[model samples]
Target: MDFAFLFIDWLGKPLWMWLAFISIVIALLVFDLGILHRDNREIEVRESLALSSMYIGLGLAFGVWVWWQLGPESGMNYLTGFVVEKTLALDNVFVIALIFSFFAVPRKYQHRVLFWGILGVIVLRAIMIGLGTTLVSQFSWVLYIFAAFLVITGIKMLWIGDKEPEIGNNPLINFMRRRFNVTDEHHGQDFFVKKPHPATGKLVWFMTPLFMALVMVEIADVIFAVDSVPAIFAITTDPFIVYTSNIFAILGLRALYFALAAMIHRFKYLKPALAIVLIFIGSKIFIADLLGLEKFPAALSLGVTFAIIASGVIWSLIKTRGSQEAHSNGG
Candidate 1:
């Protein structure tokens, strides 16, 4: 049974329970903004690690509980979707790090902007999940289309290797720049510049570089969702599964961004692995109908994907280091 069927098959609490869950999520966000993260500063490693662990533990705990309540199968589906989304999101981290460096974002202010930026992404992806769920339920063929998109995306990623993203000429960024009196310098993690500085009272003051960075971040997220949403669809067509898993994964992203930022360059081969993972998922979705294999269990897929990513990352790190050492020592 696939996601929609699984939704019916799995017994869940009433609508009120779901409402309560959403309410709690909102409360968490409020607390994060109002209390936990009131002061804007560079996130410390220990704090980042704690939040990352907490978010991950919460997701896994929820998944396990779901497994106990629903069955191992659905639990696995949730985990699979979460893992895929999480791994794919790692690529985003690399780009974000580059963006920060490119714009010369101060370490202290980085988390402040990213925290809000990720919140926006959550809202956007939520809408996409709802839309995808509706579309997939009504038309079984939509799965094949999503599969095809992923395959094509994978091809593009592999064919175009080791180049910086071309965000400089993005139409939206250009247009926004032309219309607004954007500040050339960054403004302490402020996404938008309200107007002239209160002290200066000058008309030249406008949007800041941080705002531009936020737009770039959102643009990347949109492009990424195209590939990621389909990957999740392959795992399960239930919109709830896709949305919940994605949100849980994303909730940890800010912390992960900080924890993994320094090591991102070390995992140089991550993009190719992501491309391969996308192709794997896409092919699975595309061939399911042809093979009369309606069910591709999540645990198997998750295990295989994790192994592939780990191997690729480890190999790349070792090779990169070996090359540098060889050059230095004349081996």
Candidate 2:
């Protein structure tokens, strides 16, 4: 077979780079599902932390590779995008927990839903990032819109603070229930199960609560992506850096969910920090324009983003130490 196509450019990067990233993601998923978790079981917090750490290590290592292969600027952009995406997804954890709780999904089966949900996310993010690239390439001014949207969203987040999503009142859930043949209870790890129709007394396919939970999780990611995609694009319009950093960050965050979901309430200050980060990220473009610079310094952006998130995490840990103990004792 001719290997010339591999060097052909696609979305501002050589096709081989995209293929390599895809191959790595597939291998990681196979290892995670086939080797590590062939049997359905609850992921303990310690195990979750370890798995998440491995993913994070791999993500950062990929950044190092980008640094060696690309340049320091690209590396900084990747790191900043990764940090911003990962932290932005912290809010997603709370929503996932709420989805699982609302659907009454068993702890052991939660990983199944999330694993499948990741496949959906991969496709969804690709579509979104692709569209974003197209728009930005064609209409240079669209970045301003994205930047403005981020600023408004950041302000809204700051004003609203942490409000638990009203999962039960969601229209999508209601619509699914009204439109689909759904079972009132979970059927093990199955999203859909063949069963006799209740009214017609004929064999039919029925969606379990597990499936609904998975759908909700997918939707939640899409919703959150609206914020994160633009945020990353603002950092670097290079599709390769944007997509790779996004996937890596999400892969790690999904692994981290089991640990974070259990203690999501402890991160009380994180929302505010994330809001500030958004405001900072969004304002960078305008700030650079005001300073008559082509773009903001990637190093400064990375440093500021890291410091803000680290401060939030540290502050949350300190403030919630007593709450953690109380929760343990109460449980």
Per-model TM-score, in order, reads 0.86, 0.98
Best by lDDT: 2
Best by TM-score: 2
lDDT, candidates in the order shown: 0.78, 0.94
Estimate the TM-score for candidate 2. Answer: 0.98
Q: Candidate 2, residues 245-293: lDDT per residue as tens digits?
A: 9999998766799999989979999999999999999999999999999
Off by over 4 Å in 2: none
Return the TM-score for candidate 1, rounded to 2 decimals. 0.86
Error of 2 at 10 (Å): 1.8
- Model 2 lDDT, residue 90, Cα: 85
The 10-residue segment of model 2 with minimum total lDDT is 249-258
Model 1's alpha-carbon lDDT is 0.78
